[model samples]
Target: MPSYDSWPSPTWKKIIEEQLEQVEQMPRADFDIMLKKQLPMAVYNKELMTGDTLDAYLEPHAGSLGKASFFSHQVAHYNAKYTESYGTDLPKLKVPVQILWGEEDEWQPLMYAKRLVQDIPHACLHVIPKAGHFVMEDEPGQCSDYIDRFCNKHP
Candidate 1:
């Protein structure tokens, strides 16, 4: 059900291979260049945040994000462990489970959420409208409400 239940498709494989090469070379980052790339994709609604907010979000993580070698190592480890149990690793989970996702997620599309719901037993999915990868930032009140409801159900 999950996209990575098997090896990545050729397109992804190519991207991964290219990223591996880039990470190995450990290229020096130009933040100005990177920010241009990051800002456009990071959020669906740029207007929701002030320029200062975006800076605050990106600045602290800039160092970690720049650490290509470390990033590559983690990716390699996860790639090695990829399996059919990828998304449903906790199938027999005893606790309550609810999967909340952004309906308009640019990277992870609707199919991913649908597959996740099918794979995880008893996991209900909530797709927040007009939301992207950053659901909390996109719909804070609704996200909080979902969290609160999940907590209440479990407790």
Candidate 2:
């Protein structure tokens, strides 16, 4: 994805600022609310989040993820540094590369995967069908299989 690009062409700071306000205003830090609000955007399949998976996943890292300042710093850092690194320098990688992406990812679509593969030498992209940004959560078996295959090929 293009650095600091969006539908409205707003910088990363603006988006994070809006989210920071929402996080502060929420009545509870409950995972359920987050699941209802953000999970659809994160996960491609709701079936993968059944039982206590979301709770278990969030409980361990809730504190750090809940921090507004930390999030703001991350957004700023990424927007500031990404263009110089990933956007511009990605093609410099010489080692074998495998891009494992969710095919249904709306945030970063298959085009980004293709772009990465095209730019990086010895790079291949594997798209996990019916999966979104959280590909591991949506299709753990396929994700793991692709990773194992890639590692084995590299090794």
Residue 49 alpha-carbon offset, candidate 2, angstroms: 2.5
Per-model TM-score versus the true fold: 0.71, 0.73
**Candidate 2 overall lDDT versus native:** 0.64
- Scored by CA lDDT, what does every candidate get? 0.63, 0.64
List the lowest-lDDT window of 10 residues for candidate 2: 3-12
Model 1 pairs whose backbones collide: none
Clashing pairs in 2: none
lDDT tens digits by residue: candidate 2, 37-97: 5545657886665558766655543564544433455433545344435656777888998
